[model samples]
Target: MRTRLAAVAENFGRDLDAAYATIDRLLRRARAEGTGLIALPEACLGGYLSSLGSAEDRGTAETRRQRSGPPALALDGPELRRVQEMARDVVVVLGICEDGGTDRYNTAVALTGDGVLGVHRKVHQPLGENLSYAAGSTFEAFETPVGRIGLQICYDKAFPEAARTAALDGARIIVSISAWPGARTAAAADLAQDRWKKRFDLYDQARALENQVVWVASNQAGTFGSLRFVGSAKVVGPGGDVLADTGVDTGVAAADVDVEAELDAARRAMFNLRDRRPDVYGALVREPAHA
Candidate 1:
């Protein structure tokens, strides 16, 4: 079946209620445009921290408290229940701060009317993110109405092993939700010209090409406190082509394609996953020299 998917690039402040309302509005827009699977920005449930402990932040104790991020919620929390209700028609993959027992995790979950399909606790931490949440241990893909889908939060996509593990586990599509920002030092007059935007686009294409899988990338947009996000949400085909994109703006980027057929076509040439490579790549697991 030819399916339509979207990656949303937008801003959501530190208000959970406001975030819910924003999601409600986006869902309506996506449904109207016939999007079947939608990927939302990281921390879309509320908002990411103003500063990930940048030197500009005040007292260490206070910065730690503030950067801890939105109020964490349980799997069956009211916020998600409301989303589950609204997700009756399409599948949604988005990020949130998860409250489980005594620990908080940087988590992403895929949901539908049938309830949660899969959940991924972000495994990689960048900058001061480790101060805020617990790291996940594994990467596994799950079956959904869309296809065998895998979830990866920001920073995880930077490591080739992350997506390769998912593709090896039978994932046909991977969604990476991020709160990525532009160059912190080189302030560009135009956000689109930011160097980080170039890196973001490169990673999305490389990951898709190497895995021969559909890639959906969503990110936060606009400025939030000290951070200015580079909104470059996009969907990449199995052959590393950008199918749709929202460059430096807050909007939904959608594309319609036969995902399985694309994957098959891409794999027919190289069979990237089928070609065994583990025996020659033990160095990947070893400690590396600092640059």
Candidate 2:
């Protein structure tokens, strides 16, 4: 049973109404295309950080105040409810700045018309991200109508362990949502040539190949504040081949794949999971010794 999956590459901002409108339009298109699952970019509800680095790095007290970060939304808030209504039957995965009482988290959620099926708080915070949000402690795979799926936010994909952990927990598909920006210094004239863009694409392929799972990557497009995004949304097969891609533009990358068949074929020859030597890898869990 082949299922159609779509990964979106489009810009979203602080305006909730505008974001909702974009989401509504995307959902409509996915429905028309008969997409079973759709993945939206990180911070698709509000937006990502206007800039990386710390407030002190930018200088000026007013500049620091301006970088306070995106609106913190509750998991059960009306904002998500609206998305749920729009989702209806499609399994939608997207990111948000979660309001966790005293703390704020960079979170991703998988949902349908029924309600949220799974949630993941980004465990790895890059640059000065920790200043804005608290770190998550685990990578979990949960059951959804689409399949056993896992979620990862920007920066989370940089760590191989993040995706590997989810695969070990039985995830057949991984949706990685990112608001990834291009090189800040000496950037390429063509976004396709950007180093960060290359890294972003490489991570998607490597993670899928290693886990032998379907990979869907979504990212922000165009500019937001001082940051310029790469916008290379794509879908990768278990063999690490790109099934569909939006390139360096705003569009949806859609692919039809029978997830179970692909995984079975990839694992049949060299079953990485079954060949694991857990006893010899004890150092993986040890705390690093700082100089």
Candidate 3:
């Protein structure tokens, strides 16, 4: 069945109340547009850390003391219930900082009025992100009304194995949420010409193409502290063509696609999964400590 999917490239600051309001607004807009599924930027609940400051001034100690991090909500908290209520009809994927024991995890939740369906804790951390939260170990996918879906946050999209593992686990569509920013030094005057934006776009297409899955990507727009986010949210086809995008602005990127047909056609010609060279790529499984 063909369905409308949406990705939000909108700005979300540290204000939790404002974030919820924004979510409510965007979800309503998506529903109005007949979107079955929608994805929001990473740390959309509260917001990402203030800044990845200089090495000498920043670390785990600094990220902890200076950066208060998110509200640290539980998996089945009141906030999630509120979101579920807002998503009574449509499926929504949202990023949040999860409270797990003594640790806080960079997490995303897939849910509807039925409540939680799937949860994905971010596996990769770039810059000093590892200092703020604990990393997730597994890349798992779960079933939804739209299709088998997987969730990955920001840096997780940079790792090919992240999406590959989800695809191998039967993920037909991957929702990647990010708070990605422009290059620290050589940032382009034009948002479209930004180096980080280019990488962000390239990666979205590459992940969808390599995995032969529908890619719905979302990112934070505008600036958050010192980091200027490159909001190029998009929905990419199995063949790596971008179907819809929000460019570098604050808006929702939505596109309709026949998920099953797209995946089938992309794989029919050349099955990237079927013609695997696992025997030669034995090094992939070896412990990272050895590498």
lDDT of all predictions, in order shown?
0.89, 0.92, 0.89
Question: TM-score of every model?
Answer: 0.95, 0.95, 0.95
- How do the residues 67-161 of candidate 3 rate in per-residue lDDT, one tens digit apiece? 56667778899988989999988999988889887778989999999989999999998777777788999889999988899999989999999
Point out the higher-scoring one by lDDT: 1 or 2. 2
Q: Clash pairs of candidate 3? A: none
Clashing pairs in 1: none
Predictions ranked by lDDT, top down?
2, 3, 1
Model 1 over residues 128-233: C-alpha lDDT tens digits? 7776777998899999999899999988999999999998899999999999988878678788888888888899999999999999999999989788899999
Pick by lDDT: which candidate is best? 2
Which residues of candidate 1, in runs, are more than 4 Å off?
A: 56-63, 66-68, 289-291
RMSD of 2: 2.2
- Per-structure clash totals for the candidates: 0, 0, 0
Give residue 210's error in model 2 in angstroms: 0.6
In model 2, state the lDDT of residue 188. Answer: 99
Candidate 2 residue lDDT tens string, 1-291: 999999999999999899999999999999998999999999998898888883444654334435656898999999999999999999999999998987888899999999999999999988767767788998999999989999999899999999999999999999999999999889999999999999999999999998889999999999998889999999999999999999999999999999999999999997877888999998788887872
Error of 3 at 3 (Å): 0.5
